[model samples]
Target: MNGLHLIAELHDCKCAPRLLRSVDALRELCLTICAAPGLTPVGQVFHQFGSAKAPAGATGAVILAESHLAVHTWPELNAVTLDLYVCNFSQDNSVAARSACARLIDAFIPERVEQREIVRGSCPK
Candidate 1:
């Protein structure tokens, strides 16, 4: 796998307890992740839908040089879904992606987490 894409399903998150209801928090997180070394954010957008009182959640994506990072949060459930994708490009950016991802996960401090890594691009058959 030359490139790496990480997906994490966070359960019972604590860092952004109220962030699930605030699109602001979600956007901030995305921006922070994109600021990591080797990442270049091209564009970003956030969405809020659901109950007016409680707020459904926040969903958005940040386009990066290697690829992109997206996040979705559910305040009511104290759960969040996160994705970090970085291509090897000229060199290996996988380590950078993982380091950046660790920061995001640290922020959530989820009680339970389901994470996976997928290899992208072509290498050896």
Candidate 2:
């Protein structure tokens, strides 16, 4: 399956603290980004790490028709990691994937961002 995978590490995120700790907020953001870039969301799951009063962070995955988007947040460290992949089986989805990834990074507004791009299954079969 030819695809594009985007990885990003957000360090010292400057967004609202609530965004870092709230599962609802994270889930909503992930889903919304998918839509903006025209990615199909078939299903989703998000989980909060700790109690509300002393929350840790959140982790979630949005399974997409093209591929998937996964996010892990560390509120205590003001950090986040994002993974987005889109398979180009029927059509090239790289642009959409990049757009979605960029939206996520923009939302976090981190002081520093570490990013990588991996080309998957591109070799001729």
Candidate 3:
């Protein structure tokens, strides 16, 4: 399947503390972004990590009909990494993928961003 994949590395995010450490908050943000781009959400899973000796962080993934969106946050470092992939099997979903990525970036309010786009599963003519 032909698809567009976006990967982003965020540094120095200034979002609220809860957003960076809470699994529920991250999950909600992912779901909202998915809806904003009209991506179908089949299911989702989010996990929180850290202990008293360490700083808390979160990891989440939303399973979409077209593909999936995944995110990981490091509160101690004020950093985040995001991945969004959409298969264009039936139609072009590049726009939707970009929109979702933009929404995520807006929410994080990162001071520095490193993003890349990759075209996957292309067939030779």
Q: Candidate 1 at 32: error in angstroms?
A: 1.5
Candidate 2 local lDDT, residue 95: 92
lDDT of each: 0.83, 0.94, 0.93
Model 1: per-residue Cα lDDT over 14-125, one tens digit each: 8746677778887887787668665889888788867657688889988887788988988778898999888886878888899888888878888999999999878634
Q: How many clashes show up in model 2?
A: 0
Please give the distance, in angstroms, between residue 30's alpha carbon in candidate 1 and its true position after superposition: 1.4
lDDT, residue 21, model 2? 97
TM-scores of the models, in the given order? 0.88, 0.96, 0.93
TM-score: the better of candidates 2 and 3: 2
Model 3: lDDT to the true structure:
0.93
Clash-forming residue pairs, model 2: none
Best by TM-score: 2
Residue 62 miss distance in model 3 (angstroms): 0.7
